[model samples]
Target: MSGTSSQGEGSPGGASADSVRRRRVPRAERERQIVDVAVEVFAKRGYHATSVDEIAELAGISKPMVYLYLDSKEGLFLACLHREANRLVVAFQGAAKAVAPSPELRLHAGLLAFFGFVAEHRAGWVVLHRQAAELTEAIAGAAAEARRAVMAEVADLVRAGIAESGPASRLSAEDADFVAHALVGAADSLTDWMARHPGRTPEDVTLRLMNMVWVGMGGVLAGRTWSLEDPGDAPH
Candidate 1:
């Protein structure tokens, strides 16, 4: 009968155990904390050089616990990729959606968000942009998927712009797709350019890009065509 009563708060050690349990982080939060630390380490050292032990130590958790939560180093890296990629997509989508319905403004907002994310979350951007590609097929696939998602968003905006131009607009859906690929590719390469030119704000980069691309796009939509035959039209 002495051990019959449950371990209530009055029981010796019961209150402390209860408190510890209460203080224990939720699984999702704990995983996120580990991933946060992992992102920084992986960004600094890259995937090949980064160790799970380092990540665990930085996270204030044991190495095995990191493995337990994320399954393995690859899994942890994959988790980082998926999270950062989703974050980038969401930032871009959110900014574009929050803007006025004009496709030019929407594209500008989305691009500003993308550049801003790269500037602010440099570690995350490095992980997603630099680290994901050279890994295993699954990792490569994830990176590719992220690229496709961004491309799709850009394509949709281009398609809208083309539609709004009415019958005078000469571009088609294929043109939208082509423009999307060009824009996404240019943006990817320009991140390096942006790194070199820190003085340029995201808005500056976005506006420059808009002028470079959208001005040409506007001309194209108005049924303008360029050819080598026209030498006088070339810029001095």
Candidate 2:
């Protein structure tokens, strides 16, 4: 009895000896952890001020391991940018699909998804929008590419809206592009506001944006115009 292992070389709790061994993280999982920590540190300290050592420490991995896994500091930052950017794009795409009947509804859904993503992933959002600008040329380019991709999605939504409304919408191709750019710019700016106002829900943000966008589009379609020269021609 003394020589034999009653618990199969494990503790009396019945876990096998092998089960008690240190858990090994898969390569992909570890890489994700590194990017996540990098995002947090980079967002808090800005890209130039953030150090690999700090990220490695927060990730519970060695500095050398981080370099080995991510290649270099720039590489790690790029990885974070790519991952977070793709996440937002996918979130918007899925929301667009979820509300397919109306172009305006799809846009509302997309905005809701966008705000929710930013609220849930504040660190990732900050890294993509704020810290990405502080990085080197190559890294900044990667982040900019991501923004362009999201803008393209918005543009597609605008195209859909114009098509659905036919000639009544009165939005030309050029006009749609311009509106898309404006919407994307407004959303980007509002995201910063959402970050500062954590108490605001994604639904609330989406509704406010929808009001501004749809009302303006409605006015444009209805041939309504406003001018400073006409004192009574101001927008309500």
Residues 91-177, model 2: lDDT tens digits: 999999897588888999999999999999989998888878766899879988998999888999888877876566667889888
Q: Pick the candidate with the highest TM-score.
A: 1
lDDT of 1 at 171: 90
Residue 50 alpha-carbon offset, candidate 1, angstroms: 0.4
Weakest ten-residue segment in model 2 by summed lDDT: 2-11
- State the C-alpha lDDT per candidate: 0.87, 0.83
What's each prediction's TM-score?
0.90, 0.85
Best by lDDT, which number? Answer: 1
Each prediction's Cα RMSD?
5.4, 6.7
Report, for all candidates in order, the number of backbone clashes. Answer: 0, 0
- As a whole number from 0 to 100, the lDDT of residue 192 in candidate 2 is 77
Model 1 Cα displacement at 119 (Å)? Answer: 0.9
